[model samples]
Target chain A: MKIVITASGEGLDADMDSRFGRAKNFIIFDTETKEVSALDNSVNLNAAQGAGIQAASNAAETGAEVLISGHCGPKAFRVLKEAGIRVYNTEAKTVRQALDLFLQDKLVESSGSDVEGHW
Target chain B: MTIAFASGKGGTGKTTFSVAFALSADDNVTFLDCDVEEPDSHFFIKPEITGNEKITVPVPVVDSGKCTGCGRCAKVCRFNAITMLGKKPLIFHELCHSCGGCSIACPEKAVSEIQIGTGVISSGIRDHISFYQGLLDIGNTKSPPLIKAVKKKGDGASLVIIDSPPGTSCPMVTALKGADYTVLVTEPAPFALNDLKIAVETVRILGIPFGVVINKSDHPFPQTEEYCRKEAIPVLLKVPEKRAAAEGYSSGESIIKIFPGLGDEIKKAISTIKKEAVR
Candidate 1:
């Protein structure tokens, strides 16, 4: 399964970005092969409006089945749910740590959006 | 000729001067309160509203039955108002600017326009003066359309006075555009003087002739006065700060009504504006 993590920098050692929509980069990791790739999200980082919806579309386009971020807004959550993407929230930890928690089934999956639409 | 009262800084007495000037003008004058966000001139004018119309903007509505969600609408939207989620498109109305580009870009003929009210434009009469004002709904960010609706009512009046919203932004430009002349009202302070320079630049760029009216002129800030002299911009009027005037203003009374002698000064200012406008 492909999992996308919101990250502030490249590689698994990068810190997790708290903001899902305005994160500086998105790291896509394959659970089986452990292959990792970085997707630049700077375009939506400074958007005047609708950054969450745009970011959700970008994540969905990657065909990732799951998303791991520090937080997710209502609009982005709705969009991701429509795309059949499961979202999980985590603390301010490194991408590799979040992946380990998810692999151990210790990460809490979000039932509903944890933040407001424009957050 | 249309005269707009503008100020780059908020609470710089744009509405005060506009209401006072409208009241002091002849009976055929028309007052357009273009500050849709907070139309306060209605408090002083007390126009008997005869007509009210809703101001709307077009937003795209998707027909789910025919929509393939090809993502064309989402791709064409510069505002990011549309996004294709799975096989459907979600439209964010707040971010929509009613540009109609998304509707046109929809290949499935599934997009249609629906009008949503952002504000209201009301027209009425105060004595013999025709009064119009636009009131933007709280939380609505689209104000330029409502400002345009207010300005549309000023076409046939012998004299049109527009009370512009404060700031040198798009809303202020919408209010000040196409006016024969503009009267920039500012207080005598460093902050106000700084904003006044920006306002002056805006009008000058628009190629509109404008003069300055220093409200609370007795506050002993000479830098504003010096700036006006250096730029050769006419000082149309200087309304001295008076306790009675401030009290009356808070009670929704005009300056001319509070101090009847100021009527002469307003009259002189009007004449000066007319002469400058013609030149």
Candidate 2:
């Protein structure tokens, strides 16, 4: 299964980006293959508005089955849900730790957006 | 000629001067209160609202059956008003600028436009003077479109006076666009002078001939006059600070009626604007 994590930097060791829309990078890790890839997201960091919508489309197009982030806004959550991507939040400090928690069945799926749009 | 009265600072007496000028014009006069956020010229003109017309702008809707889920519409929308998720498109109406890019970008012709009311225009006549006012709906951030609707009523009138909203932003620019002359009304104060400088730069950039009207001229702010002189900006009128002007405004009366001799001053200012604007 491919898991997409919003990260502050490259690789699984990077910190988990709290902002879903303005994250620095999206790290995709394949659990079966143990392969990792990074998608640069600097274009949306300075967006005047609607960064979440653009970021959601970018994440959905990646064909990732699951999304892991510290926080998600309503617009991004809606896009993820419609794309059949279940969202999960973890209190883990790093992307690698969050992935580990998922494997251990410790991370719970988000039922709805935790914050309003523009948050 | 179309004369727009604009100011960068709010409550700088843009409406007061615009209303007085409209009343002073002997030719067919149309008063457009373009400050949709807080239109107040109607209080002074006291026009009998003949009727109201709803103003609508086009927003895109999708045909579910025809949609190909190509995501082209979302890509074309710059406002983030539309986005696609697994072939489903979500529309956020408030963020939409009604640019119609989505409908034009749809390859399958699945997108169509629907009219949505943003505001209303009230039209009436106070004796021989025509009056038009735009009242925007609460929570609606769109005012330019509403201002356009109100400004259209002045098309055939001999003289059109637009009372623009405060600030040198989109609302003020929209109201002042295409005017033959713009009267930048300001008071003798620091904040008003600061905003007036910006307002002057905006009109200069737009290439609209403009002059300054110093309201409350009795105040001891010499820097404003000095700045205007250094910039070579024409000082058309200086209305002395009068207690009656404030008292009359509170009672919804124009200074032209409350203060004697002010009517002729406005008339002279109009002639000067006509000379400066060159038709």
Q: Highest TM-score among the candidates is held by which one?
A: 1
- Looking at model 1, residue B42 earns an lDDT score of 89
Rate residue A119 of model 2 by lDDT: 69
Alpha carbon deviation, residue B240, candidate 1 (Å): 2.8
RMSD of 2: 3.5
Show how many residue pairs clash in every candidate, following the order shown: 0, 0
Q: lDDT score, residue B245, model 2?
A: 83
lDDT of 2 by residue, B1-279 (tens): 899999999988999999998888867788899999989999999999999999998889999999988889988988888877767887777778888999999999999999999999999999767999999988788799999888898887778999999999989999999899999999999999999999999999889999999999889999999999999999988988888889999999998987788889888888889889846
- C-alpha TM-scores of all predictions: 0.91, 0.83
Candidate 2, residue B106: the lDDT equals 95
Q: In candidate 1 chain A, where is summed lDDT lowest over 10 consecutive residues?
A: A110-119
Candidate 1 CAPRI category = medium
Q: Residue-wise lDDT of candidate 1 within B97-124, one digit each (tens)?
A: 8899987988888999999998999999
Report per-candidate DockQ: 0.67, 0.47
In candidate 1, list every pair of residues with a backbone clash.
none
